[model samples]
Target chain A: MTARRPYAGLIVAEVISDAADDALVLAAGMTGRILADLGADVVRRRGRDRGFERSTELFLSRGKTMSNESTGELLGRADVALVDGAVLRERGRAGLPSVSAVLSLFGGALAESDRPASAFTAAASAGLLAMVGDPQREPLRLGGHQEAFALGLSAYGGVAAALASARPHGVPVTIRASLLETLVWLNWKAVPLEGYDALPSRTGAAAEWQVLRCADGYAVLVYQEPDWPRLKAALAEPALDEPRFATRGNRLDHLAELAAVIERRFLTLTRREIHALARQHRLPLGPVWSPAEAFGEPHNQARGLFEPLGVDPGVQAPRLPLVWLDQAPARQAKIAVGAA
Target chain B: MKLLEGCRVLDLGIITAGAATAALLADFGAEVIKVESPTYRDPFRAWSAQDEPDAMPPLFRATNRNKRAISIDLKRPEGQAIFLRLVRRADVVVENFRRGVMEGLGLGFARLREANPDIVLASISSQGETGPDAGHVSYGSTLEALSGLAWVTGYQGGKPEVSGRDVNYPDQIVALFAAGAIATALRSVRKGEGGSHLDLSQRDLAAFMIGDRFAAASQGEIVTRQGNAQHHYPLQDCFLATDGIWIALSVPASALPLLSDGLAVGDSDRPDGLRKAVAAATAARSAGEAVSFFVALGVPAAIVNDGNGMMADWGEAWDHALQRDEQGLIVKGFPLQVDEAPLAIERPAPQVGAQTCAVLAEIAGYSSSEIADFAAAGIIETAR
Candidate 1:
């Protein structure tokens, strides 16, 4: 039998909020658990007597190592320190000691502090301390679970980037792909030059240039003006010649009318029937598949995009961020702390 | 100084996919030289930007920060020659056209490998280059829907609501991952092992983000929508405070009493006690106050903030924000701090073809006359 090789390992100091909400705990716990799953050594320094359920270990923490040491004690030995300043203060600790890096898991005044004192030593913020809070809401607090996850992710990214640049012989770098920045970057921003602050709008289920639903499933499709004539012929919809539906513009202006026409046309046949129609016309269309549906899709299964993990029998995770090297197991269990 | 102070990247990307990857590299201190076609400028110059032809577009500026740009139309034989020359001297090349586009342009891997076998090439596309769907065209939205992310984004009782108007943002996230991967690959190449082509599909990666749910779905378990309702605890959800602020709370089952006692609400034993207590407590206090009080008690909670506020706080409190140039471009700098030295922001984003003449003259050893002739032949577009 082959011995299992751990992928990553590190200890961490985590601070929780007093009278905190459930979301924050789940967020912090889940984040730590996921890292542990990825083979990292994860220890929770719960200074204020907070306990994590073993059930969460089954579901979220997986194979991670857990502890109830003071934040100060954990910080001295940790490679990464995730601090919820609100949680630290709840224990009535005056301040937190600094470590190599501090991930501000929440926002506000503690988020405002560069240095954190805990059961560990006094942290002077020698490393790249990053602050990430969820900015989707009107006003934000620290340790909003999902937002804390966002900050933790950004912290992960910053750490990854920082390490990438540390070695003397490799391409060096510093990263700033923050969660908040990521949100802004993701947003369809208003055009700066013209003050147009929107990207496109949502038009549901109408495959203007995508898949359309049929009786059984869906078929992906595309429509350029060249394809329009072929599509009209295939659907046998003479109404396309009508003034309101003739040009792309007129049809776009009255998408509701066009959608109604297409939906009614689609309802007449099964997914196979639509696939045949689309294929014969050489339209760009595919079936609308759920992840479950995708698992069974002949094409997906054939392409080697799914890999099974032992965590769940008959459960295969999608392979992505595809690497040329042999696939490593997805970070499944927490690495043992202080283990080689 | 930034950690990547002396590193140089040769960028052959256009539009969102490849360019965004290169942009991130530039953000991290890699000197990215954006290679473009002298004849047809970056189409994003026309379509994506809010600026006129003569001005820089905000889309371009946002992503293209801290990099130099030069025009060399690889389709033209001379342009290909110049780009190959640059590749031999660069650390990486990022491109996102269809699979055969680079090969068709005559600057394919074989030709470039002849110049520098170790030069890293990152091929970003809708689907991977060798896959069946490699030829497919994808913007962000279509890619999102195809990946099953959009299928899971809506409310419990409603159809999945896609956020934002464009393709899902996972495209950029994938792009970031690709950048990180290529950078990691470059490390291998520098050790004399040679570079490897990274085949990253946006669809494949975005699917991984929702891996936990997918793991269950594979085994006949369907995870449904709950609209901010947590699976573990009932009260762990986003709530609307009286100030019209949305605050998210995550308290353990044991801390329920602490919350009840602090807010002067009924104990957790009451039928609707925890819910009513939480609502009243949050309502009576400002979002910030509620957050502060909770933090003092060692609970898990946070308030959602906006962009300006986030940037503002980083600028003011956290010393993480980079200083911008007069043009408001984030100056190039070291992203990480070492031994209390603040990361330095060195240079701002460059203009189109800003260093064409200088780079060609200094690095490529092209004389003024040859450069002028190449310029006349439309081989390289000069800076305005």
Candidate 2:
């Protein structure tokens, strides 16, 4: 049986946002291809000029059919339309009477509606708060392209919402997504928690919850309220008997002292030995794994989590993070899509 | 207010990395029909409370809400036949297998395109499907290391600490990108263009998170571990409140003068006074009051609320979590507008192969005898 078609094979024309970054345009094009995979009959639209990267075919045109036409011509057969950066900037400012026009030998009549349009910007609503004022004086650049990516995510939601809302309103639904908005939302929600500005600080062997430099390798030591007694008993540390080191609050207040005590206890223990002890105590524990360590980890292997790929027919790439019922993505397809 | 009321997606993926992508798709009103195996189901089906042998896991429920699940053994020629039919009707197929696994099973892009040339196919991977490192093995943690995120996420004078107890940050990043890409692609398709292939690497997605660090490194800057210490703003960091919980405070540099005048705890020249004053103020007030004081002044501040805090907040202001069972096994759902649509929560995650027989009968147009034979031959698992 075939999957249910959400829309009756209504021919639709799709257009992407032409922005400064080719990465986004390429990514958007690839995403369009994925949407086609979901059942939208898709066609690829190119910009007026080529980008700095000649690899648009490899990146964006993968899994998609190519097409060339003016925006006006494409819009005629389009029942659904996907638009990007150009819509939000000039059209809104210029105050166009209608967002779209009809193609005609002799103009019969034009149909238009002004119901609200759903827009998805890579930026979240919250992310926008940072860039409210001036780009020059108080410019807010995110630490990364997360803002842009988030906008992309929001755009997906906005497109669906707009499409959903439009049917009832009898209007041609258009969705707006921006990179700026997604970042704003993520920032507002997760706001770098503290020192999020700089490169995340690098911690070496010792973590807040686990110790890494014991034995030749590293070990994860987990301690919570339930496991503290077992840890104290295992280490035979008398300081654990002290009132100030007994409760969660007491231990936190005197964290430095407690850390020292725990360090002293761990000094004589090997990583393997400690891991065994942790297991016996039912504490959450593991090893500080490098890629090599991960390859040999029994738990991971048992889970059948690894999915190996062939970069070339002879050359083996690393195992991937996903496994599709003992299957991997098609490498030949990647080549066909011009990924290489 | 189904956000994606008219959107449709064919989810040809499994487990967390791909499930996360589909789950996010389901959150917005995209009709996602998840293709699972008849034998094992998705791996998540077996992951549940250890005590409840037949129940689906909470982790699966958290990510797989609001989507239909179907079972088909793609290895069987008939199963491949069924999938091609579905492909002809699908708008998107998001799969994150290693590499070449799809082709080996005869379910490659060629087969998919044969059914529908206009289909958009997104093959998510640990590395990518191409390049020298295309075949590298990865989990969320491994991706973190390759992307240099794990390189810089730890306390001062310590080795890199791995993050995430169960969920991987890279997986979420991929899902976010996938969702965004599909939205843009739909726009293109509407404009009479074919959808494009999105080649997103978990490594690249992870690297994007630390772009600032890479920029700094390009300029030959070495950043050392400072824990929660901020560079420019003296007192901008997570500090211990009186209640012993961590509170993140972002005091503007311009507020240094005001802070000095109000607190009177530090000297004008002693830069350490800022830390001292914050420490003092934090110690004097309760966590709530201290947060309120800073919040009212336009200072960005928040409590480092743990799982318990999360639960409490969910119960109070939003009631964001819903109990899936009588025993109060809860699943998290999306919270949009206060009075929009009633939350759409489905049954908890499926037990492995729990829906195999039903799915085969309904989606695959298979009879009971056929399903029984497949189950008997170890090709599939039967629900009953």
**Which model scores highest in lDDT?**
1
| DockQ of all models, two decimals each | 0.16, 0.05
Give the alpha carbon lDDT tens digit for every residue of B21-95 in model 2. 776667666667777776545665655434666555655665676677666677888777767766766767888
- Predicted model with the maximum TM-score: 1
For residues B1-384, what per-residue lDDT tens digits would candidate 1 score against the true structure? 544445678887776667777766776667888877666656566654343456656555555666788887778888888888887787677887767888899876667777776666777777665555556555554454555654554445433333322333555556556665665555345333465556667767656555555666676776544444444443554455667765566555555677767867655666277767776777878877876666565455555433333344443333333345566643222222333223344455567688898888877778999999988988888887
lDDT of 2 by residue, A177-269 (tens): 333223222222222221123212112222234334455444444454566777787768788789988787887577556756676666677
Error of 2 at B109 (Å): 1.2
Q: What would the per-residue lDDT of candidate 1 be over residues A1-340, giving only the tens digit for each residue?
A: 1111122534544445454433344445544543454345777654343343232233444455567666556655665444443544443232333222333322224443422111000000111011111124221111112232333334443443443343442222222222233233333232122434532323444325433456775444445556778778888876667899878788768765776677677767775576557557655343445677667655455457776644665766564345452122233222211111
Query: What TM-score does chain B alone reach in each candidate, compared with the true chain B?
Result: 0.86, 0.84
Give Cα-based local distance difference scores for all models: 0.52, 0.48
